[model samples]
Target chain A: MLRRFGLVCVFVSFATLPAHAESVRITQDIEARTITLNGAEIVIDRIQDSENRLEGDFARTSRPCPPFCITPMTVAPGVVTLGELEVMDFLDASVAAGEGLLLDSRLPEFFAKGTIPGAINLPFATLDPANPYRDEILKALGATLTGSDWDFSEARQLAIFCNGPWCDQAPLAIRYLLQSGYPAEKLSYYRGGMQVWLQLGLSTHTPSGG
Target chain B: MSATARVTTTLNAPPDYLGGNMFLASSRRLPEISMLRALAIASLFAGITVALVLFKADPGAPPAAEGANVTRSSAGFDNLAITPTAAVPQVAQSVPQAGPRIQDQGHVASLPAVAADVDLQAMTRGVLAELGVTPPAPPPTDTGADDPLHAMSMAALSGLRKMTGQPDPAQSPSAFQTLIAQALQAGQSDAYIDALLNEAAGSGRITVPSALVTAEGRVDTHVILSTIVAQAAIASGQDIGAAKVSSSGRIQPGQQQVYTVSAGDSLGSIALRFYGDMSRYNTIFDANRTVLSSPDSLRVGQRLVIPTI
Candidate 1:
């Protein structure tokens, strides 16, 4: 009788093995799919629809040049332009790991429409040296104010993005951050922005009641 | 030796099926066969578990890049800079692929079983439904961000804002800016927006954006969302949404609006559509002066920034 029971148990175990290992992850326990701010939770993932395409103003390509010109592959020396997958890795390794921030360098109104998951809108305008609170923003980014000079030793890894490759708001911010002595290695530019992110149907967050 | 002979005798008496020594076959062979079967099952589970662990492993994940020199002494903070750490080779920034080209959503199949959201879980169904994942728990109240200082600064500032009833600012931020400041304090993700748009698109309940076609030649879902929300605001008699959507594509009325030049669109025509007067073509011409030689530089499908008259 015991043998029969053991045989039945073995069969049940064999039948149940289907590889649903949820706890297993490539990175930290955050699992690279979610971000939480204050008390709000933001789940990050690609749009389930493989057929999704870029739409709206981002899709329109005929903006006049000079201001809307295609940005160079690299914004400045030492700074790297990150693609979507690398951005995901950065989010996992740095942002989710709490050593980095995903900054949206566009204006507030554009950010209000919708933005990549886990992004905080810091608007390109504020990164300018002229802004009085710019120092406070830097302090928020992990730059310790030592007397008059800013110390960026422990500054947060900033992965900044704007509308798309055509829009230089992100590049502009990167230049300004460098001018303000933010380390080049600490910043990453997501060149695709809404143009590529939306085209691929990645998840986006819109602030509730905005 | 005698035990071996007895097993041979039992084998030689394989007339068990023929009703000769059936008991012998059951007595000796049963335990060995069952034991081997149990071993095989255990091996199977072990093999599968190892394969799964390897499959989900982040093989592409490189070690976290450390700064080359920890002692970052700028012109200003020469005195207080910390001592330098051992210089490490900084990793070169890798160029990302041009195409995120609609590949299989294979990664979605591996979504951590820990995440909890009834709606998202339902959406995640069918990809790996057979692999029994636990039902998602309730959304977490807190997942402490890794950047303790960033979180702390935000907390401290917002707390102070709450106490003083005003942010200690030389320039007061706009209402939109205030929303942004408050947004960072909370926790969240935006899959809800995508799901909501899908629901709205599926039911034919939402209006489409006036832009005939987007860069991808598909309808703009986000713009559609913006238009709907803006219309809802207008229905409350805000008199908004008439003039311009910024270059980034919010259906807003403000100083800067983007007008896509149609086939017959001269600067004057675009000016007429945006403003009440036709002579205000120069408003657009002047705003885009960096690209336009004269007012005649307009081309079909070119996006012109129409500034307010």
Candidate 2:
């Protein structure tokens, strides 16, 4: 009976082995089709390979200067730069628990195409002090007005990114937000953004009504 | 192997009713003649059965089945069967017999009458009438455009006065000299005003004095020249759609200019300030297509390249 049981164990082990020997192995243990974000299941998967020969703008090798230049590593003093795994962790742990927000600071044109899951577009210019709509935007971000003074006690932590490290839209947004009294410790910068996210074969989804 | 060869082999080979024992043990023959007769009859039946099996198993049978579908009811198949050797020559003969001579005799004389019956103009007019669309009227010709002074009106002079921020007068100017005096009084240079008058005159507006039209070397002011540049742009057939006056009034014609987008700014408004026509915003959009994907969304502090048209 013991011998039979051993034989069955060997057979099961052989059966469970993968078909391809050279397939890549991921370091992170993320195997689920969707992840929890803000108490909802957000799907995480790479873009499918298109049959057509044409490529998209994010897939391009280069873009114009002034707007698409690479940014510095440190945006603010206490703000920490994040990678894909760290960003995902932020979304899964902080954002899902209602302690954080993910901001895609690109203009609506780029944001409308596709973005990282769980990201909301708050264009960089909207946070400018000179912007006429700054107060309205600040109010919408959960800032409360008390006797002509703004309070940021209940404001969630923000994770901002744009087209990638090369794009300044998000950095400008981070600077503006920092100037507007958002705590630097509460801001996480996803510097890799959509470019590196797509390069690494990560998933993205278009937001509703984007 | 060929179908005929396979059939022949099945006929000659002995059937295996008793397995290989029939051939091997045949030398130990049966003693009675009746036994030999029975064996001979059995062998004959077996040979016929084997032959039918071989024929069914033949590979060449499928092509014959396909040919059956093709010639199931051909018109000339029966006739071809009666004279098989002449079939190819007869088919070849039928083709050229329906040659060019037959086509010419049948079709040539009938084509011109068909062509003559079609009237393209009448057909087009009939189609137009059926659609209930009338032909557009011809544009009117103006013979008085050569006389620039004849087109002067108080309304145009008043419009110019309003553009320069001057109040409408109780009695507006009806002639070119009075209008020029009002423009000069509103802080416009003589040369700049003279250029605008020439542009208006060229567009069949009031004629200016010959001396003003021929004058040169007047002092240039950035403020006055830029305003005249904008106004002359409109008179020179540009549609300067509602654009606010720029804070820095400098005209940089035929040169590259960079404009930072401000709040509530659009390609139309920007084009109106620089090129003096909202429709020419495409010039800005085309120049900035490398950075901007659409002309509708302009971010604040986004610098756009403006190419002069």
Candidate 3:
């Protein structure tokens, strides 16, 4: 009896609340509240705490234009732009199934502090052509190598993000991938990123130190 | 150095144009001296190359293999050396040169993962073969082992595969495997678990019966979790390890959950158990304000309202 109930309990976690308590939903129709990202089940929904203040690096309102410029609707040609719900869906499906990756394009230091639960830290600088090990990173994304040229026929679906909509790091990383011959069809851009993620009170997990 | 010195000496003199005023002569004759010197050195180098070409024996004369492939130019990337060459096929003129890349003014565009499976090393050598190096091929250099490029390429695939928590397909699913999967699903990292196990071993709480790494070079999470569960079972001292341990974090159909406080019970620990997050202790405190006096005060056998977060 416990085993069968345990299996059902594994699915999601938004059942009990008082009459006055408001339920946070990702979408009106759908609520796969807890999702498997990377390898763990994380509460992707809003934190139930109403008093939780937006604090730390994510709380800051503005940054300078040159480095932290606003990104476009689409990151690169043929690269699909996704919102928070789409990101959650991708995390629950493709990423969970190992057919896709949710990449956090921030530097390791920024990523280490906290990030979207399922995102792996693939720094934007590492994707640059200047990096000698760039081919290795592309291969990690499931691109097969035939000598020095990359073969992305079996490349994983990659959805990338940096700090937020104003950050160009993810866009730059996307450009680097294209330079290395990565197909734009397999790429996705999560434009809102961490800033919006915090605004919605979404849970963030600190990745283990490398 | 010897050849350059000889070339410079041979071009030391100047025509009788500028008068032998030291400053005027020095400035006027400098360009003429360098140009003449360059010509002399070029001839010397040309003679040496002619000698090498004439005398160098044919070792690996194989060019018929790459006669079919086209040599095209790839632009923008600096380290990548895909140069265009002539003399491969006659229809090569039909292949157009690549155009310039679109520059992002606001620096707001992205790139993609192209699936070009062309052999770059073979193509590089093919370019050489097209460049009249059909007589002798140089020795091959292998840059495989300890290569940072290779490591970065495989990190995502390996890291994601491990994250999946699914064992290799060859292995049959077991109960212990299920236990390990649950532990990974709990969200703490392998390094964290390793530290926990190390601490437990140091404290003499659990026996380190086996190595954490398996013979296949995979981290044996199976061994680690099994030890932890067994230790917890022994420490708890109950039937099947404890009095039916289950998470209170599960979604309930009811609006509230009531739990009688047990031994060693605290609001923080209860909050962690009920919500899967210890920091939400105030949620419980605020919910059960009528019953509990403060965050720290919790009496035995008190019914606490565990609110869903």
Candidate 4:
């Protein structure tokens, strides 16, 4: 009986030892058009052809997972113009790029007086905080996060302008877009705003009632 | 032969008593020895079981009191007293032994009240400092109320008068001179008045002339009158050349200089029309103070002094 009990104890200890180790699998199959992680897949459909190339450039700077698996993407440098760019340059680029312009001034009276033609007014106040677009902003813009209502996915290039040099509204709006993952190259700032236009003796049209 | 037979018979008869028989007898006793050994083992096992039962039944039984007094004297009583020594040795080694005893004993009696008194004094000083009042020295007295020379100074008195909208008597001449000069120099044509006032006011040096009055207690106003004539001439769309007074002391080009004041004509507007800047409107206000209670209350056809630069 003693010999039998000793044999049983040894068998139980051997059985308790681990049989297999756990691991994660990442697969990028060309046929799938998706990034598969442990059999779960996330699709990439709306990524543009040019943007795809840009993303590839971005991936060079980003850290890749071990065994050539997950590729973390970052914004490619040399896109956004730092400091100040001329308003005329911005306007010409915006028109050439076919991107819609957004004027962020909130004062309806001032907007009625005179503003950039074909520009839509979306005040920065209306943005919802829980939106993923805002979270993307913290990643792209770094520590400078002055939130605004400019969608990165909808518009390819967004030009924001306000009163003039004294105006901080457009810069703050641009910061929001840049932070929100809108490509800095696609963002334009019209620094010589309405005041400069008026001062240069350019034609200005007021709203019908104004 | 009989002795040999006797020995044989005795040997045959006593075979049971022989040493070989004794050896066989000892061999037969082995089973008995084994039984006795088993019985002794069984007895030891029973003793062990009994001892275990007693131990389990009364595990915490106290020691017997044999030689209790000797044990107490030797170690037990002394050890009981010395056990707390381990706890106290560190405190004794670390603390200063003197002076604190007196302070500890007196702490409740005198220390707290004295500390509270000092704190209250400091707080009072802070409050006084915040209130812009100097704190009183020891044995506090009300110094502010008792100060005899705390009355307002001449400069402060003048500031108070200005606040009250009453001009200081000493400064009356300068004020009067400035008012008269402004009234005399204000003009009528918008562009000219604006340009003139802009130049004059920007220059930062306006000369105030001495007051001159007429016999009937009216201000003798050669300067004011000429300024008005010149501005009116400009406003009437007639260029009155060089603004000269004839030898008879009458303004030349009288018809061209006189302006029929119209509706929507404010002293400032009129000044701007003639002086080019509205700041020279004060000239009109000073000139017409006797008739025009305020610049805003001007009547349509009221004659005004159109000051000249």
Predicted complex 1: DockQ: 0.01
Q: 1 or 4: which has the higher lDDT?
A: 1
Q: Against the true structure, whose lDDT is highest?
A: 3
Local accuracy of candidate 3 as per-residue lDDT tens digits, A82-109 = 9998998898889878788889988767
C-alpha RMSD for every candidate = 36.4, 41.1, 34.1, 54.1
- Stretch of 10 with least lDDT, candidate 4 chain A: A20-29
DockQ of each: 0.01, 0.01, 0.07, 0.00
Question: In candidate 2, residue B241 scores what lDDT?
Answer: 11
Q: Please, what are the lDDT tens digits per residue for candidate 3 over residues B248-280?
A: 233354567887764334454454345432323
Instruction: Name the lDDT of candidate 4.
Output: 0.34
List lDDT for all candidates, in order. Answer: 0.47, 0.47, 0.50, 0.34
Q: Model 2 over residues B185-284: C-alpha lDDT tens digits?
A: 3333223343344334444454321111110111111122222223322232332311223323223656787877643344554654555433344456
Q: Comparing only chain A of model 3 with the true chain A, what is the TM-score?
A: 0.84
Question: Candidate 1, TM-score vs. the true structure?
Answer: 0.36
Q: Give the CA lDDT, 0 to 100, for residue B236 in model 3.
A: 26
Model 2 chain B scores worst on lDDT over the 10 consecutive residues at B211-220
Q: TM-score: which candidate is best?
A: 3
Please count the clashing residue pairs in each candidate, in the order shown.
17, 1, 16, 23
TM-score of each: 0.36, 0.36, 0.40, 0.20
